[model samples]
Target: MSDDLPTISFDEALPITAHVDQLRQALHDHQVLVVAGETGSGKTTQLPKICLLAGREHIGHTQPRRIAARSLAARIAEELGEPLGQTVGFQVRFARKHSEATRVTVMTDGILLAQIAHDRQLRRYDTLIIDEAHERSLNIDFLLGYLKQLLPRRPDLKVIITSATIDTARFAEHFDDAPVVEVSGRGYPVELWYRPVTDGDHLDAICTAITELGTRDGDILVFCSGEREIRDATDAIRAMDLRFTEVLPLYARLSAAEQHRVFTSHTGRRIVLATNVAETSLTVPGIRYVIDPGFARISRYSARTKVQRLPIEPISQASANQRAGRCGRLGPGICVRLYSEEDFTSRPEFTQPEILRTNLASVILQMADAGLGSISDFPFVEPPDTGQVTDGVRLLNELGAIHDGGRRDAVRLTQIGRRLARLPVDPRLGRMLLESDRLGCLRQVLPIVAGIAIPDVRERPAEHEAAADALHRRFWAPLGDDAEASADGSDIAALLRLWDYLRDQRRQLSGNGFRRRCRAEYLNFLRVREWQDLHSQLKQACTELGMHRNDAPADLAAIHTAVLAGLLSHIGLRDP
Candidate 1:
């Protein structure tokens, strides 16, 4: 007879070897465990195995980003020697994998947060592992707060907070002094050296350093602030005659296929010019050196503008440390800072949590719908700015989430607001969705609203930019290049028309055939599938809200009216 439980066959040894037993015992004894370790200290990969061995048959592990969650799940599933969607699975927005017999599941934090609204007890699993908690993303903060409240009610559940070793005290303190199991003495030593330039010519300084370091034996990683810097740096490196060196870029806006190049194993020296996405979310292979300019684009809520602003600022001490750790992943490495050590030390110790730096309108709506009182009194790990919270409420009111009762104290989700909160969209888009039904244009506007929320599905390869633009222009017949279909000349009609064409094309073929069709047309097949899924979900949500009724097909005028009705506040005038 064969044993049913899966096991990991080791080729060599992993870093978690020395610490697995302690982690197992800790999980067995405590309801909450904070696992702290450096990058490649094996916390992300090893903790799940320890939990399984400690007898957690079902686990829900959360990651900060969708790609990280999917990749981690695949890695773990392979190690377990099971089919990808059988014993282990992953769920992100518009994608899900799992079976009734699955033992472990990996999902993005947003997926878990949405689950909390339906399953407050989180009855799906006995264990919950929230990875990368130190990043303090908005979803991470909300999940931490949600679990903190749900723990007492369901005392049997296990919660583990994991991050690269930076600060665990705050996380521990937040959970009634949860015991922390530290995994140390694993990561390779990385030497840190600082180089500063008073001249603002970063492009010249970076190229010069890389040219000098070309004689080095290992690959390099350069951290930049944004896309423009990445482009400039990449162009500068390619212009050099450094033999057998390849430069690649990584940022959020890149296509999935384009981003995969950064992780590809190279025969020659590889230098990755990247944004902060490479800082902690991913581990690019063979990076033996790091070049940090000590800056990142950080989002901060501006009370004056009543919106979140992305400004390039100096990296925090913790972020700088994380960037340095990227080099020492495989062996002893070197990290060169483009900023002075004194300047690095002067930055903040850790980044402010997302709760304090983001627009809170969505969370505010969720809290009100969940019966958590005024945003002023919600239990946040880090309190948001009061003025910003006030601004969020005012915005929600504008979207009709709050009653227009003229009384300050009387605030709650209206009937329309309840329906708005049901779908996973911003209140403004939600308003547009709900208003479409009344405007007699729900069917016509549904795909357009969903398409607006995602990145474009069309791929424009740089080598063939003009050709790609021409290919995209093929779909611009009805909307034209000017894309005017109504009085305001909104591009939404174009989006809807594109979605309509794709929908008809999809219905004419099988899954593989449709994918082949998209490739032939130079479109991102995956994103098109995601758009279809979003449309289905929104349609079902509307049906649940009792807003789905067979009405006359709406014309372009009504569709424009619906969009404008929801966006009246955003219209602005410029002086002539």
Candidate 2:
């Protein structure tokens, strides 16, 4: 590490930094401490430093998001006067960074939990920090329970749970009344304005307010429910005559570089239209104002429907506060709520945990494999509904992961169930991959799995969906005299063909030539690159699992056979 650390620009000491002694002493006194701090409190980045200063050399930190983990690792590395991958590193799915000298490790909660399967003691680290505990996902819940069990054995190991103000009580109680330490966040005043949602278009309100805000000093951030809202709002804003602004869309489906555009310190006015992802974990710099549409897609699993129901509903007051705080991170700002104050008051105090709303099939499998015993006995901070638990077990039994353990309702993993849990992909996709070898189609299924696992490469604009679809067909259309591809004429065949085409040209031509081919085909080049990375990881996983590898493509039926075999339970017919 060099003496010249990254330059510090903020003159105002963050709330966390002001209480270093109290935080450090609290960590020393308690085995588990809950740190409740709001956004801009500097707990996420500064806590690692406090851990280091407190002599916990090896710090294991888990974040709820990959982007947040990577970005935060970079920030901390810079602050520590060390290059990334040296002192600070992050590990996420299919991507990782670190060295033997790495002291502080940041990773997604999933990766951290995955570590438990191999390292029961977690001897590599002395302290473990779970950030973003407020948004209680399944991985976080399972990890918390597992860690609670492991702590007694590793008596020297320390644990710290950091969360926003919403769920401090639950976390503290979950750890058997772990001491809670609260830090007040940045105190800049944010002026709140209200406009109730009307029967008219919401994009109009977003556009008009943003255009008006663009005329003033700093950037404007607009929060939407989904990608459709993002696109419509972007188009409406671009259609306006704002000469000094750059309108960008931030969503989960966007490429990492495209998402980085929202964080880039541009010289001109920037308007970021994003989903609830921007509500927490990420801080967009130079945001002087925030516009909230007050609605977001909330997932509700239906046992009867056997699928997730993603309905657009009003955001809770906690989310609204989170959105407004984005503008006040660096300075005083304004928050424009596109809903009435009465409606805001009617919303829930906190958004329900995702573990409750989502299907628990995957979580149950991991828990069963992790020796958590059973879903009903799992120590979740907030237990999911009994219906969700029953549905999860039903699906697992259907997949043959669990069979009757001889008792009335007891279940155990079959041989295939153990293998399914070993695979990193979802159970359905894992089944397809395993069966592909039997059908002589491992090669074909690999690319299709990659496609499902990554973002969609075909970018469809709302205004140009038809044109985009036609352009995509150019690549999907069958090649001449190819019997394997034309066997079923399925869309899966086209996706495989596209992957083959990209790989073929890369072998025959230069990098630029392959990129040109992708552009002419209306493909997202970055997504193609991501797919290649995922494909490589899949191949590695298969090889490690002692599966035979096929170096050549298989016939179309072989691929479709495997895909349809896995999706048999999901197939349903609906009336037109």
Candidate 3:
């Protein structure tokens, strides 16, 4: 232990604080311990410190989201009175902040999985904490399964699984019935009001609820289904011109500066419209009221079609309760559900694990790349269906990622698979990059592949949809001697053209100027930044793999060929 360690103080009011000795001992006596702490229990920030105090050297804490990872690392570092990246640091996609002196590393679960390639044994950390395990995301389930296999080999390693109060026993039982320490939340009373939406319009209901709550004491947290809902509700609420209330939006894709504003002090009351990201991954401060619309866009994959679908559906009962609990942290609070109690009771008890719901191709490819044995043998908390596993393997084979081993389940990474595994992209996008390399059009295809990874950068404001579309049409590739112009009516061509235009503008303008240009052109500035960041990361990965850019000019046919390699299954025949 360092002699100059900052004097640490625990907030006695936190429920998790009371379990310090018990948690520390649990860690000491057991190789794996499960912690079930509700929202506001301080478990997310405090558990890592407990690991450090238990004499654990380096700690690796995994969060389900990048925002949560970054925010939690900052909070923990602040609490330690140490500069960020010194005592506590975070690593998310395309962003890393950590130094040699750092003892705790907070990272998205995907980042940790990526580390499995370089650190197969995860030997750098003496302890690993998987936070938000109750979310049951695909990555968390895979990490849990991976750790289950790894624990026996690395007996000295300590694993702490933390989740909300829901379904903690299953996690404990998964780890051979590891001891579970349940901690209560802030003991504040929250009155639930079931105001079922008589009409299907959530915006009207949210606006009506806001009108009712505006006269109250503290900030209001409204849970919208997704970003569009947040934007729509923000507009609707602002239209009402509520007196002295600040309307804000919170979601995963918002810029760091925008997200910081939600936490900053504000006058009067603040109305925050957010996605499920706020449900458990983040805690917006000073929320004395909650508005639950009872719906969220849940990602479900159709193995038959091999398409990932994000459809707005009623939230599970566990999720609904989690959203309601957000308000109770600050004294007495009220939660007005936009749905009736009968509707809430009709929903599922808990959410289906993402492993069961999402495409398993990426997970299978990663496992094959790491030589983690067959996916079938992997010890997930709930193993995916056999057909889904088979479909995943088949997709890899179609992408030339797996060798023709004459076995449906046998997974052996081919040369192409090896390169695909090196890049931190979806297997489909990885295949496109490989195809681009072979077609000598990596430069043209790089942006398109990266663009496909994120939401479209083009923005069409509701009020200016026509103008936005007209301005957006400026990027369409010209057809010889034709008055009508399009990207040959291909989405890939449009992406390339927009990417080229943005790159040119970026070269001519300052950073702020480029952002202004994006706004003027109705492009999603944050999404553009995300596209650039992901592209840069992919480029760096390609360079490291000795795949240099081709100096050839733009090749339309070659670009389409490269793209086609990734979308063979997506092609359909149109009947005239």
Candidate 4:
């Protein structure tokens, strides 16, 4: 918005800037524009600025990640010769620094959906840009459907959907054939090597290949599907101690500080082990080699069991291409794929839309809060499973967030339900936190509830089986009356003694004991922080409700009942 800002160069040797300009013009003329560009194109970074400079109005861009939103905002602001959050700002969960003068705001798609819940029409901005539509996340898909219904009504609003490998024709047909603009990305020669795994090797073969490759000068990026594989691969590489390699793990579970380490430059040759999160939304600097495991962890929802399972599956061809493009960012590079060429030929061209696989409860709650009625009538690029939709409605009804008996023709939230939705937590955890007040065990119950909902707090050392078991024992609550016995007399004392032993062992012997305590367990630090935060919030809520914050613990039955209020759905029985 400021003319005094430094002139940014659009004079890149790439010919895509013309397409960017064309897309910008189309955005100006029509209320919606769909732009398709290949991987490595400057579209994600450059196009928003084009819109900002051309429109002289506020613009909002949504990314699928907090890291991507923040980093991309900083990069674009740097190019404009302005500090981040001055002209370009970003918002993620628990962090925001946007001002009235800010012309462009970038945020995760979830944040945008949260915003829409409060302000249904998103009246704050004149233009909205949805980046990475090809990801087909439930939130992104819902936003697309909502915006399609919104465009004709809000004539002044301009929308742009950007994706690298999206089927433009399909998207165009979805949007009633919105103007489609294709942009060619900067091309680089990349050599692809496909190696099929035999019976002897699993993912460990990747580390062996890296070691055999021997002292590559540039950064190495390895793509796996989940945090477990990333951590396992990183540990294996560290065990090998390949000279001059700075091993770093990248995944969503890491704290913001830890995630930032992967983006910063390193002195020695770097090896970044990451999930599919790094495949599309992020751009890591100085990568020259890519190791593709060809598998990603996908969250699948089961309507019959009403459970969500995270499993590893082969990635789509589009995802593989994006992984390959990581190597070519600087110049010509090599992609070492761990699957056979024939396997690659048989893989699906594009990943399935997340709307089809994930739990639709949250999306349904959001739509109900926004007065979107049942999600079935909402126009989606790919509609979710009918059973999943029914399951979502049933869950909402069970939670009292919606009152649609068996049919989901109409829905409304209760007062208690509205408060639960306001909390930035899963509905179950939110319900648990709220119930802590009525049960009068706000202190102890809130922390455990939050802990369960947050990431795990235990950290296990690699292959330390004994240590992992010890950590689990330290944290695990005893079953039935045994839990009560532990809470009573010498059980607490015995637990304290175990903690002391762990503390002492951690102090000495390089915390191998502590690592051993967590080896088999999936402990995460963020979950611990969330627990702490939940405790603080529950205390605050208690004070607001006229309950004493420092009251003594209530009856254990009440505490368990409060926990059951939220965790009823999570309850399971074991067979004898």
Candidate of highest TM-score: 3
Prediction RMSDs, each to the true structure: 10.2, 8.4, 7.0, 6.9
State the lDDT of candidate 1 residue by residue for 89-141, as single tens digits: 99987678899778778998878877776777889889999999999987787
Write the number of the candidate with greater TM-score, choosing between 1 and 4: 4
TM-score of each: 0.70, 0.72, 0.76, 0.74
Question: Roughly what TM-score does model 1 have, to 2 decimal places?
Answer: 0.70
- Pairs that clash in candidate 2: none
Model 3, span 1-576: residue lDDT tens: 466566667889899999999998899999999999888999998998888887887999999888788788988898998888997999997789999888899999988988887888999988999999999887788789999999999999999999999888899899999999987765588999988988455778988887776588999999976565577578888888888889999887778778878878888889998888889998899999999989876766655545544455789999998998998897999999999899999999999887777668877877777666778888888877887677778788888888886244578888988888777676777888889988899988999987876667788889999999988876566523242734467778878888988888989996558767988898876567657766776788898788868996867899999988988888789999
Give the per-residue lDDT of model 2 (tens digit) for 1-576.
223223322224788877888998998899999999887788888898888777787899998877788778987887777888886888877778999878889999888877876787989889999998888877788888887777889889999999988869888988889999998665678999887658445767887677556577898999987665576578778888688789989876577678777777788788898888778787777888999988876655555544434456678888899999888866788998988999889889888887766667766777767666557766777777777677677777766677754221355778777877777666667778888977778877988876766557777868778877776665555655445454444678878877877788779976557666776666766566657756776787887787876877677778888886656687789789
lDDT of 4 by residue, 523-565 (tens): 4322322334444555565455454433785665676676678
What are the Cα lDDT values of the candidates?
A: 0.76, 0.77, 0.83, 0.71
Query: Model 4 scores what on Cα lDDT?
Result: 0.71
**Ranking by TM-score, best first?**
3, 4, 2, 1
- Scored by lDDT, model 1 comes in at 0.76
